[model samples]
Target: QQQKCKQYMSAELKIPTPHSDCKTACILLGQSLKSDLMCQFENHIADFMDGLIEESMILEAAPVSAVFSSSLSDKERGKLRHLHPHSQGKQFISRRSLLDELFEVNHIRTIYHMFIAALILFILSTFVVDFIDEGRLVLDFDLLVYAFGQLPLVVCTWMCMFLSVLLVPYNLFHLWCQSQSSSHGKSRLCSWLFGSVYLIYQTLGLGFLPTYVVVTNSFPPASCFIIILEQVRLMMKTHSFIRENVPRVLTWKKDKNPAPVVPQLSQYLYFLFAPTLIYRDKYPRNPVIRWSYVATKLLQVLGCLFYTYYVFVRLCIPQFRSNSLHLFDLRAMVLCVFNSILPGVLVLLLGFFAFLHCWLNAFAEMLRFADRMFYKDWWNSTSYANYYRTWNVVVHDWLFYYVYRDFLWMSQKHFRTVALLCVFTLSAVVHEYILAVCFGFFYPVLFCLFMCFGLMFNFIVHDQRKGPIWNIFMWTSIFLGQGVIICLYSQEWYARHYCPQKESSFLDFLKPRSWSCQRPLMADS
Candidate 1:
């Protein structure tokens, strides 16, 4: 029986084929099996091995196959399907948030409790300090009030943006679809009509309007951030809606099919409020809303807000607000950056926990959206590449699908490195825009870090660097990056308020004001 099985296996491999994939699989399977058991179950084993090879064998190229792969055309190479499991891109599943699952563990819960205790201590220390200084405990939220000023305008601006996004994209697409049934010339006219309107809406309506309002109003950091962040989110959503749907429209036109029914108005509206940037006719949803979970997450968000305020007031204010340090002096700047590291790291943690984890999860729960992976365990990332991917997975998904993959598809799967660089630049620019608008300056520190260090680390310190030392390296880089950002931005903020440029130039706007301001040019607030 063993001899017969061997002959059958040999015959199977000897069959003419385009490639040796199945032959290799068959050989490996025969060698891996127990020799003693193979004699008794030789026929069965042979059959099983043959079936496995048929199912699993695929044409995949590796380093060794580069010589052969080089001869394939760009079109052919782009069409080459990867059957390997690891090659598959993101597959989102309905699951609990990483933090939600982690908190169930006693060890993680204790760490959470420790943070709560620290918050309590901060509150007590503030009360005691205020009482000692003023002979009464001060409870006024002057800082919070100033930071969140012009709340009404922010709400109004967001409404206009959201309403425009909701109406403009969907209705314009509907118009375009209706036009498809008309004469070719008429269809072209309608396409031009709605297409131009959509472009104007995207450019003037979503892009310039919110930014103009924020800058014109001289909005405080918090208020400016709200408008800017919402603007970016809506723009991304609008793009995703169009990008994901336009292909279907084109396909219908190409196939000469009846115009497909447009996306339901309800679906578009739900997507506007949904946590995800990707548009779909439907999404995985929970059977019921967990109101308790929603409430808990929202409360955590509030806690983080207060936590940040305290950090800025206690650590940042006392240090940067001092009358002593020169804003631009080398020694002073170096000291400021190093000293700011602790608070910078704290604020970083707060921002991640507040927005990405608590805020997004809260909205997801309220909406019954079940794909709860807003972020992964980015803190455990040993490489910056893993850190970037794991950090804020929601945004990464949008960039990956719309920006990265679309670039590949457009470029015919060539210039992968170029595509990566473009993606990095766009991300950096958007981030810099956020900070530049919110803080009202053009420092470019974050942009430099992203483009230089970030792009380099993405290539160098990839997923393979899993040593404990790499984790330390990752943390150190983040800490220093955050410290420089906060220190430089804080200096610029104070400099702008203190040293109001009596008159400004294009150069002044382009240059960082913190570099020249040595002392207050205006009186204290």
Candidate 2:
């Protein structure tokens, strides 16, 4: 049947026909085909010609931008193609893409945001654990070390100021050189060490400095988001070196000075200046996207329910049974667990709300300050990537535009993961420092190590390029696992370090406070 088809085609088409046995082999003009019978198949001239044209065109168009752009699948790229059918063959070039509209409807900014949300979750959970332990509701074993030992060492007054200064520049430069590197792991490790040491020194200064200096110094409050914003605003506006010479400023593209007209800029403004703007068009009519909003709201409702239940069990029920109950209420332990878990879980569930609130508020504050101060194009208003660039405006600008870029410079691959690790480590240390300063503990180092371990695990076990669900799962698992471990570790540490010895007076009772009436009468007589 094959021979007949070949003969008929050769006779009718009048084309140069390769021997049937050598068809596949004969096509290998530049490369050799080994002597395997199956490899020797004939090729029709027509199909070969068509395929050759496609290959040649692809070879001709292979530039770096083309390569990066082509990394998107054909369907993925199709969304960016000129929507107008008539616009075909004419390269459809829009400075921006509705990347959020296509596929899983995620923007690069959203992907960046998974990290941000995760960071916020980690921070809030840490706070909850601390607060619970402080209230003496739940046993936190690690609190004393974290509160007393670790933080003072990291956030010493002089050390914090010095390390902050050093870290700002070092992190900035690391981002700058990220693009040049070949091994992101090595670069990340280097940056991680440098930043960690800087933080350590900062803690040392802040911790051991003279009490006079510590008390009198006008250190900025870490909780004051506005203060951080103000500093960032001043830096962007007055500090030309940071805005210009500090490598890729985190706004849209590499060469384009951040333009307020960018979509991301508008979103940032919408989030910041007019928050209602976010809810306006985001769910104008889209059901699936709206469902996410609904899901978040549902979680909030459930969290409220749990929180209410916990309060009742811990406070109301205890009071109700106080008169009748003689033995220790076993249920109180259960209630404590619920109370701790409920509020912690609620804090996490409500995290998205806080994130949106903080981001929008922060964005507006940044823009208001940046516009009045820098007057430079400090905001970009397009793409999820640009949204990330504009919203935080500091970290994105520092890490992605600078640190990851530099990491890339030192080690060319693994830009995303390495950058992520660097940011995570810096955050863990800073948070630990904050908690340590507040409580006087060395537990932050352990916390940071635990975090780094989680990050490395995710980097190794999960393929980041996988779809949003996969990425979400990996993030959620790591964060949830870290929270659980930290809680358990803290409980154990608190039990060991902070647990009170039985009060000496309670045991000894050296003097009596009350005397019999007869003894008082005898003394008077």
Per-model lDDT = 0.80, 0.37
Tell me the tens digit of each residue's lDDT in model 1 across 1-525.
Answer: 777666655654443356658767677566545443465676677789975664443233333223111233343333333334233234334677889888999999999999888888888888999999899989988999998999998899888888888888998888788788778899888888888999898899889989999988999989999999999999999998887777788788888885565798999999999889888777778999889988998999999999998888778887876645364577877898999999999899989999999999989999889878788778988877778778987888888787777787899989988877878999999999998889877889899999999889888897778789999999998999989988888887887777678787667767877776777433333
| For model 1, the run of ten residues with the poorest summed lDDT | 61-70
Off by over 4 Å in 1: 1-92, 258-261, 323-327, 504-506, 520-525
Candidate 2 lowest-lDDT run of ten: 516-525
The most accurate candidate by TM-score is 1
Instruction: Tell me how many clashing residue pairs each candidate has.
Output: 0, 77
Expressed as tens digits, the lDDT of each residue in 454-509 for candidate 2 is 45553454322344554455445534544443343333323323332365342222
Report the lDDT of model 1 for residue 433. Answer: 95
TM-scores of the models, in the given order? 0.83, 0.34
